[model samples]
Target: MFAALSEKHEHKKVLPDLEGAENGVVMRFAPNPSGPLHIGHARAAALNDAYIKQYGGRYILRIEDTDPKRVDPEAYEMVVEDLKWLSLAITDTVTQSDRLHLYYALCTQLIERNGAYVCTCDNEQFKVLKNKKIACPCRDQSLETNLVLWDKMLTHGFKEGEASVRIKTDLNNPDPAMRDFPAFRILDAPAHPKVIAHVYPLMNFSVVADDHLLGVTHVIRGKDHIANTRRQRYIYDHFGWKVPVYRHYGRMGIEGVVLSTSQMRLGINDGTYTGWDDIRLGTLRALARRGISPDAVKNAMLAIGIGDTDISFSWDNLYSENKKIVDPVANRYFFVPDPVTARIEGAQPHTAHAMLHPSDASRGTRTLEFTGTVLIPKNEVLPEVTMLRLKDLFNVKISWDNGMPTFTYAGDSLADARAAKAHIVQWLPAQATVPCTILTQEGEMSGACEPAVRSELGKVIQFERVGFVKIDGVGDDGVVAYFTHK
Candidate 1:
């Protein structure tokens, strides 16, 4: 079964080689501190970490936190924690907020080199002219005048949106929006979490300055950033800096969960979501809480590779990868949801010993003592099904007395049970059951589980007829667990 499950993901595709990697590659995973990193954000991170691991190099973690309105103060730590959970190592960490001075110096130099200008034109009016392929009046301002305007932008001489710095690109470029784009802007409201500045550099400008300054050799990001990459390249050419090798994979469309960080934060604020690790959200915190290992995530991502074609995130592929990693060691147990007790007639007290693992005998067995009664899931009982085999125990024929279910003991031979077409089901003795509540994506399911389940706390285990789950808590009330996918 496991072999067939794994064969589905065996594709002939392999990851393409990184250009100029022989010169000691230096890669970075730069994420905006808006919210916790979602699974959609892991592709870039995992690929960069993989390259760094393959070819020894510096892996930098840059927190792009320049947009104050979009920034979440708590997300700084959350981003780091998420990456740590993904096991991506960083040789150095840089916060863009701390390096505003660097961007300012470079902006000033770009003005001096005639690579940029301070545009005082209204945004809408400039767009009208730009769409017509006409340069705004401020685009031709002298270097000295532009420098003075830039100083005003820094010293509150220019109020928010009154003036901005625009990088000088080909005005005749096919894409009008790409012509002389805004590199820096003034925004004085909603004080930034880390820095106190009215003027801030946009993504393209800041990314170019930081990547060049930090000596980043490769930039691996989604194809959605293709326009941004093109804009950044103009900056690199203007300053005559070596542009890094670029590899842009297609957008990863993850289905069946919310991946938008902003939407998740809104849900969390409105009480629609419990937290970052709410199990239904696509954040890494959610995956970790449900016992999905970092290696499984990484392996699943690597299998997808850095392909340019758009792809959806496959939950089946991830579950298959995870099952391969967790199946061999996950102990087996019995749990009954919405349990119903069945009295057994003509049956003697017996001890049933089941293997901890189906094939690993050395791991030993769990001894369950039964006294002519067993608890089974209510859903498994049916009027038409007469005989049922309580797995690893004797077979019993279902009967009704006083409108309540009863079981009459039959022969214990496995072959006889098969001949009777008795459906095997997981059952637990009433004497040795523990209350269990599993937190699933849909909701919580309460039931009775075998006592041995308590010993598997803080580990992943499979219930005999149900899916795998991670034991999260054991308290006076009951055992609390998070249900992982089958």
Candidate 2:
């Protein structure tokens, strides 16, 4: 519960001071440590970090663990780890859980100044005023009575559906949030562990006090939190504090589906994905499962700078960006799943060498130990044809006939293999293992998808004949379990 400290940086608008001169202003990524960080949080955290990096201001990582029901050491640690993995910089860290007393103290001070009061109400009581500008019965209590009541509530502690504290405001205002809103309430169901300990004015106590005390000169959060900003501004106004510059961008939405951190947490915990790293769900862990490099993630997300509008793009675009980052350095490797053992029927056990990368010979070469028999990994053989990498196999067309895997040496030549399309794939003998799992959609399974390795897991890899090879798991025989394009 140390008083909030601000990080300083130097920027002269046009020039940055080299010797630690007058670096002024500060910004932070404040996230609730209630659940795991999701795509929305990632975007907000990234933008805020990028802004601070650009302007040479301090980028602080503040944990708004005010919701005692969900706050925890684990959640705080996870947020820190997740943000770091996302390439967001944190010059400092703070947790709100450690500062509850400070907030309560501030609330008490407001009550003392006759700006707040205590009110006893139940569930039906708050709902009656939920959207209406109706005044609570205790709004007009004298300062003495307000103080006494507030003290009573403070000493009496909060219970489920019981008394609460209210900020005396314009009861007839059109904005329901503005009409004599409760500054604090009994939380029988607090977000964190200390639910019954202290009542809170969700936005007022959490947002306003934190921002001002932390010297957050600029707010780079998502638009979802924008409504709370108005209430926050009111608190600032009451304290006569200068408001910070606000940048509210719409939360990022992944292709075809809407994803919220709230939603992700439910899906992730309820077995909707393979943990959080299912690769297809738009979570950072999902990105990692796809073998995405941090640079690729930052590049793709950062491509769209901070904007008011939400970012929406196909899952493919993100993979495409990730491919750009991973393609160059990813060592060429070959994998065939659901192996339909392909016997070339007497093709000599020969060593075929191909460039690791045709365009860049410096990448070296790999020698495919082609024997008379090869495991075509049935997953790779699709009704459609795809090229099979022969270790260093340059674009090679694979054809399946009569359940055997074979290479077409003439129709497609070595010259053709250089093009990405050169890798043609089909059954070695025109028929392979009856279809297997394909791990696409990187999301974990709830009922069936859990550990269901389909083609989605290999979203970043392109299969020659099949769309993509979905690696399900490593097999006991040293073979990989795979499913064709899902």
Candidate 3:
């Protein structure tokens, strides 16, 4: 798999042509609606979308909800929403539950051809025979008897765990998991949540059948499904169907973040996490809430390509990519955390101007009328500093009288300030300041920002030397912004 990385890297801006492209490329993203999509699933969706767009082919969104025991009806919509959020325009949508009868019909055909059989082996008994590499007694039953048992399975003739329709494979196959795998099994629907059928096709069987029926020319999925691909090949060969081109990508993980849906669901239930969108979580919803752009997520995943070597990255890696994209557009703002009052002596009221974005002057400027008093970050005050430049304003000399620090006009010349090695600090006129709250991954931070921040609600802005933040809302009391990344 890693051999293709060099070719992919060579054409990073273009999606590589899939094998058998002459048939008109078609791809599908099949997601199980068990939980909200995490970053891993997002990568798969993005790759499929990229390929379809590159080839001008069809894309399908297949909801794999066959496992009724784990299906969540609401998650069906959530998957669609997540794909839309990522800007993937799906050509069609499908639900496996709606096609249960098709799967049943296929199973019957396989049983009639002796490609599969209804097995009554209990768990322990099956394990013993499986370890011995011997066929179970049910495997030799007459085709008519197996057909009757299959019908019984559909009508709840056998209880859950008592019967399953297993696809026939070499009993002595080196890989034990590939030996006579179960294609469909009985589920006690009454004990399950919203199960549509007592008999449901397993993932291996359902996926293979659907892929062939849907005319998917390329199947892009995680390398972890390599075993599944081998198991599915049996079904394809039995039906004499063409196997779609398979491209498997390695698992991409964010360092220090757990992407387990089970653990996250448990956390939500136990109040360890507020919800799926909690800042500490890795769900697409959580990343969106933190102001991470969908483009950033897509670009980051695309850069990794479809290699089988697992990749581990850090928050900084994603933030660095986002910063490059957002820095040129995010307007600048002044925010003073733990604000301290400072009075400038020998200073007259003057209007100060700062560009909204340093790189894009066309964005215009933010204007503020300065009074003598201003608010500066309290923690930024340096006892050793004798002079500092109020950024985009005038230079000021610092002095302490009776334990109170004061500022005096030094000069308005930038050249002189630079010669004096004065530190530049951001400040907001006390009267023009508005209360602001910044919600960070750590916690909520209260501060004062320029009044200009009030009108930019829902826009991303850089807080001078702090970080980028998306203004979530504004009110008479203050502005609420979510920290994006530094």
Candidate 4:
């Protein structure tokens, strides 16, 4: 199930083509409205979007909210925002809660065809009979009786946990789970966010009904849903409907990050994480905060392809890809963390020009007026170092008088600094710097940065020796930025 990658597109790896591409292929990304999409969700979303784009078909974003217990009211819109942020071209949006009547009609049709039955058997007793390859007594009831029981379930004639609608598969099937599965059940406890109801269709049941009704042509999801696919196929076969093509990819593991929605919610409640957009969390909001572009994410997911082997997400690979996209455009500036004043003794006042970007001189440079005093990182002022180059500026010879830093003018030649084995470090003019705080995964690093960064609000820029960061805000209090990646 593989097709060569399109050379005309920006994608990096080959992806499989759909079986019926000329027939206006349709696909859907049906994520339960549990919470906002994390990095894991991006993989499936990206794959579906890529196929839709490649085939010139419709892409539907389906919000599966049938079970009231699992839905997050806020996530109804949060999921859409996440998809938009990722730049997915969704042709339509669907909410399963709004289509309950469709599921009911389909279930009734299945029962009339003897493909399903309204079962009131105790779950434990049914399991025993299913394990023994014996049909439950409810399975043999007349069609009229099943229809009456179905109506009873819908009209609240039967209480929750008293009756359910189950599909009829092979009783002698090796897997007991495949014997007979519940299609719809009664739940009266918690109310749904979008609609009020007692009879709720299970995921497998609603998914099948919607896929067929919505005319979905291809279903691509994680391999974990293999069992669900097998179960859904029974309904399609029973109704004599054409089944959509299926492609199941292996599980993607993102190491050193929390991808589970429940765990993220727990951490947010416990104050372990600042929010979903926290730099430490593996969410799209967090990635956006850190200046990770949607193109980088799409490219990264494409590189992983749809191989069956379980693969781990590589942060280094992602960072490398991001660096390629950001470096050419992100301007460079000097940021001194834990800044300390250095008094220049022999150096005269001079102006220094630092290129906004190393390789792109056409963007111009930032001028720094050095007036015999400069600010450098306190940690970089080692006791052993005798000489160092101030990045784009001249070299300085260091000395300590009464625990205070003093610098003497050294040769401005790069060759001279290299011969002396001096470390080239970033520095800012003491009078030309502004207060800046960089928010990182570890903690906040407060120091001084160039005032020129004020104009770069809401844009990504590099901090010379530190790393790339997105300027989130700038005001009288100074600049606040989120560290992207080195």
Candidate 5:
């Protein structure tokens, strides 16, 4: 799938060949309103936005809300919100629900012309003949009978399998989807007020007819929709309607990480994840939580290089790319989690000074006080001995016994400790001790500690000898931190 998307997308910049190419271009970004938008949707939205800006055309955001079984008003609203948050400007007037009359009119025309009919077959019957070529029982129903039943659907109620208006396409065809295809099914969709009269298909035929009405010249989406394109092509052929140019791209998949909406919901419900923003997942919240910028995603897509073919990418490449962009600007801070405090043996107390961003000084510098002792996360490393790093600070001297050692200010003051070329510096105070909260991947951890040297809030900084830290927020208790390593 990735290969196919690559080859076709290589020439994506070129104008697609279509019947109305002379009239100008009108492409549609039609995503189903099933769940909150994910990274995959973001890419498609980005491509659509870019296309409209580059080409002489309009990009229509058509809510394929035709799938009633899976629609959620919250998810639907979020789709728009997420796209807009990513800096996508979409026209507000384009939604499939707004044009339901067109879909119904087409179904009515097909039924009257013997191109469609009402099917009385239930799921069991349909399944039995799914593989075998079977003619629907109501295919030959009088147009008057179908019209009356259709009215019943609109005015009263439609029972399950009571009637389905199927397009009278080739019944002998091998493709089960197109074999006597059911164009509309009676649905009690919650998003739309429960109306008994309307029947909808599985998105294929509906999009084909509606795109013509809305003047959509092109269609770009995931490869999963390619088969639907084939079915839609058949409908267009039957109606003698012009088909839109289609470009399918590889569905973005994170390496070794199968993050889906279902997985996310399950994790949240089971207490395994904080919420949709869990860093391990791919939702917008997760990206924001991980401190990944929106531009990072867009640039990554560009760097990965789009194609109308399927391509599998390793996560390391993305990680490396992000690291390159962040290395120069990330501020330096001191963060020690599950902290264990140590005092520099009899060192004079003084304030520490450090640059926020060691490589890029424009961010300015911050002051931290090393009252004499420093705090460090109690991990595999022992904090009670020599050879300690102020993290982003220089190495310090320590006085040790058989195994344990008292702290010594072998390194510079807080400022001097961080003034060197090192990448991280953690502040330990020689002053009073206080209870501290440690941030970990699993959750918040608690411990006792002294002031750790840090520059600013909501910035990415490395502990001189500790782990990476993200300042969640500052409070009366202490600053909230999240550890980031890989």
Candidate 6:
């Protein structure tokens, strides 16, 4: 499915090659398993996968599950599911929790070479020194003393927040965050979900170490991480290791949507959201539930490309892209929203044939029994309307008598209706119609649709003049569908 969509965009644009990647390219998408994969995360994943496919290189799915406080085992599986849904072919998988020993060993090596030191400064003390643009007192600690403190951190001799190991960087650097940043921090082992190590390596230290050890030749991340890249470079320089080629794209966000994991967690706990898959949320699961195709997401992100300028887009942009993909395949059906029953005078019981798809006649047709009584959308019935054409059926002269709609056969030829400028409206045989509920972004809409919709469960269909919708399921009472887009 994804391969077909990717081919559509192949000729639209060309992506630049990674600098110094002529030897070979190995890219990794390391996501923290604190929450489900959201739209912003999808952009990164898709871009990396595209590069891997284009260059015929390896792609790795690395779970950055080191953060004990926020990590959820279920979220790890959800991330993998989302990647597979995006059709990302991950050649390797690695979980950081299983590599605690490797990080500790590297921490020891850094301390032994005086490249890092353990800082025991309290929060207030460090803030005071940081505000003064001066190095903390621990920066002058001897290599032997720092190593002893580091061992204590690993041995549980110090409590959480009591100490942390800091990498040696320029104290007078313009960016204070880059000055002696924390390499390893003590976590409450009893509170962690997986690993019980009290000392956990921070992202700055862990990612650099894993990238080199895991043979990641190219690193693609958001431009917001430019500072972290500079800090990681110092680590590579200290160890005399070659740094991976870095490609940082500008941050992309959906307008009016917040993708913050912390905020989402709070909303779920506070009952503002049902879960990560809530339709209002931006998580990939949420998008999937709303009938948004993974191919649509990939193509949209590919169009954005890698740039330094921040990009913000409205949901309409996504809908437009999705419409192009679904329009050709989705079958058409008559759906009357908030319908009103009207009796057709001088009408005969006839069988109407509607093409399953306007463009693809090979899909065949649907049969509808046209009885005297029919259901028409309440909104489409205009007060001044003299004539209306039942889409793919016939024209009817409409009249309002005693505030009730009365329909009389006008003609069967579409040419006459088109010449009369008659409104094209959708209608369903009242007795043969089936109940339907459409779940939209705003709220749920109740209506009656052609009985043919019931059999289209798990299929996407166009509701004639209405928007595209996916039939989610069918129960004894009604058929339920999710609105994709117009």
Instruction: Estimate every model's Cα lDDT from 0 to 1.
Output: 0.90, 0.56, 0.85, 0.89, 0.63, 0.85
Candidate 1 local Cα displacement, residue 203, angstroms: 0.7
Query: Candidate 6 residues 394-472, lDDT tens each?
Result: 8899888876777898878999999989988889888898999998868899999988898889888998777899898
Q: Model 2, which residues run further than 4 Å from truth?
A: 1-24, 70-73, 121-134, 188-191, 194-196, 255-272, 337-349, 375-438, 442-475, 479-486
lDDT of 4: 0.89
Candidates in order, TM-scores: namely 0.95, 0.74, 0.94, 0.95, 0.80, 0.95
Candidates 3 and 4 compared by TM-score, better number: 4
Model 1 over residues 268-312: C-alpha lDDT tens digits?
Answer: 999999899888999998998899988788888998889899998
RMSD of each: 2.5, 8.8, 4.3, 3.6, 6.3, 2.5
What ranges in model 4 sit over 4 Å off? 1-11, 400-405
- The CA lDDT at 95 in model 4 is 93
- The runs of at least 3 residues in candidate 3 whose Cα sits more than 4 Å from the true structure, single-residue gaps closed, are 1-16, 190-195, 401-403
Worst 10 residues of 1 by lDDT: 5-14
Clashing residue pairs found in predicted model 3:
none
Candidate 2 per-residue lDDT over residues 1-486, each given as its tens digit: 111211121111232222221355587888777655766666667666666676677777878766565565467677777887886668878766666667778877777777777777665776587557666667667878777776666675556557777666666656776655656665655455533465554556666777878877877777876766766766666667888877677666666432455666677789875565555465665555545556555655556656677667545655566555444434333334445565553344455554444455786755555544555555555657656543332234566677555754332244555454544332222121223344445432111111112323333333333333334443332223222222
TM-score of 2: 0.74
Kindly list the per-residue Cα lDDT of model 3 for residues 271-376, writing each as its tens digit.
9988888778888988887778887787777777688888875677668767766776789989888788888899899899899988668889999788898888
Clashes of 6: 0
* Prediction-by-prediction clash tally: 0, 58, 0, 0, 45, 0
- lDDT digits (tens) for residues 326-385 of candidate 5: 555566654445666666665676666677666566777666675656766556245443
The positional error of residue 70 in candidate 4, measured at the CA in angstroms, is 0.7
